[model samples]
Target: MYALLQSTAVAPNSLTVIDFLADFVKFWQIIVFVFGAYQFWANRRERLAADKVREAQELLDSNYQAWLVVNSAQGKGGSGGRIDALTNLARNAQSLAGVNVDGAWLVGVDLRGADLAHASFKDANLQGALLSGANLKHANLEGANLSAAQLEGTMLQGARVSGARFSAASLLRADLADLVGWREIAAVNYARLQEIQRAPHGFREWAVEQGAEGNAVSEDMSAENFSTQFRAV
Candidate 1:
């Protein structure tokens, strides 16, 4: 205690004072540095958030403009614009529900997982197009060519496919027959579960033989009543 009092009793020397001042300066420098770093990080986060919102809004604006082109680009000499807009919408996975593009040439367009509910593609050429996992509920595909198209897991429950040939196309696990508008509507889900269209080769053949039908399942066939009624359910 006496030694400590002797060291601190009098004012410290110039060296001691300089050392204390240096430590004080370093402590505040660290505080200032930490505060500045936090501000920088916070500012960076705000900028990133703003950029994300801006990008989303820009995308929505683009889709809206494309939709405008799709609706207006009809009648004659408008297929080019319509096709481009449709392609953009499809690429963006936008809904094409109830949008009519009759007789448009959209061969090889990529429409995977697109929402095409109630869309009219009558006489549209979609040969070799990618339509896997697409929603085609109540869509009109009369006279549309879907040759070599991919329809794996596609929902086609109420799509009107009259004159639409799925020749060489894939229909793996696709949704079908809900458009039949059956009295037993609950059975529709079960029917979709055991889709005869997606049957094993042997099972399909056996069912065909049991039904005494030909190998070809016509698009005009009513799968519900096992009749030859085409168009609406």
Candidate 2:
């Protein structure tokens, strides 16, 4: 062995042989280290991700049970205590509509249906939450982070949604009547006229001037152009 090592060390091509073996050993070690590191990181990431999912699911189950209690009370007479309990559960449910749960940590809660009208949820953390069919009418959701939340069929009428991030959120068939731009409001007015024209309720020349609820007023046609071509129909 000594003779062989000495021959390899002193040989004319000895440098090349030493270099090749060194490189081969380094390459094999690097491959093993890289795989071990990768496996460790992957397992750690998966464990953390699974923990978050489990926590979210547990919150959903708790909220659903609270919903059942509130739902049962609908057929019976109740007082402020029931309202308080429902409010507490609503705060936990991922479907919190208009409740005053501002700045609460509510990640991944399920709040699909519950009256949250005029509730305040400003700056709440609601990522990955399910809020479908919830009534958020006139609710204060300013600056709330709702990224990855499911909001399908939710009523967002008159809600204060300034700076509220809904990126990648689901909003299929959601009621955006209050959030309509001027152009959409105009379209609604035009459709309303068409409905009035096709009414079988003897509504000849019915007009809906914007006013406080239910009170109707007539516009002065004489002050404006009376010709059919110039009519404001």
Candidate 3:
């Protein structure tokens, strides 16, 4: 009779131990689930915070410079967090035209298809920048370093290119339809271009005179400041 009583006591202890183990596992699972939810919510909030429209609206109610607003909560930062801010500014469709962005350090910036019409990029470091299909009409690009920049299909109609470097830059089919004087100063070394015959009148003859291999080439790194930016594209 005593042994049966001991056996019953041991059975209850075993059940209690099992219950404790189950509770411990449940507690840890709850912690893990809470942590995961927190992470997801944090990431979602970050993306929402980078919205250009929201920032624009906020600007109306706050005191901030348009340039300072370019920095996106800054994870995808460029040289000195300028990339994030510049990108946001470029994407925002609010009267960017005629804004003076002269001498901006925008190296390797991906501004494809942004409406940069009439914006002054004079003397800017645009090396290896992706500006394809972007509107640069009537913009001032004087003395800009566009080496290896992808300007394919960019609208450069009436834009100024005085002393601009196009070394190894891709200007294939760029809308230089109204640009003047590029043939005199544009450095087209290894640059991609339309067939000389298909190019705007006089571009092909100019390419052959410059001794390019089926393309226009110029060895003039005018002012020796133009450096090659080994672009992958």
Which candidate has the top score in lDDT? 3
lDDT of each: 0.65, 0.55, 0.68
Evaluation by lDDT, superior candidate among 1 and 3 = 3
Q: Please report the TM-score between candidate 3 and the true structure.
A: 0.57
**Could you report the Cα RMSD, in angstroms, for every candidate shown?**
10.1, 16.1, 10.1
Deviation (Å) of 7 in candidate 3: 54
* Model 3, position 170: C-alpha lDDT score: 68
Model 3: lowest-lDDT 10 consecutive positions: 221-230
Per-candidate clashes come to 1, 8, 2
In the range 63-102, model 2's lDDT, one tens digit per residue, is 7776565555443432313444555575664454434656
Better of 1 and 2 by lDDT: 1
Tens digit of lDDT per residue, candidate 3, span 156-183?
Answer: 8888888787766767677776675677
Segments of candidate 3 deviating more than 4 angstroms: 1-66, 69-81, 92-95, 195-200, 211-233
Per-candidate TM-scores read 0.68, 0.39, 0.57
| Candidate topping TM-score | 1
Clashing pairs in model 2, backbone N/Cα/C closer than 3 A: 94-109, 94-110, 94-111, 95-110, 95-111, 97-116, 98-116, 98-119
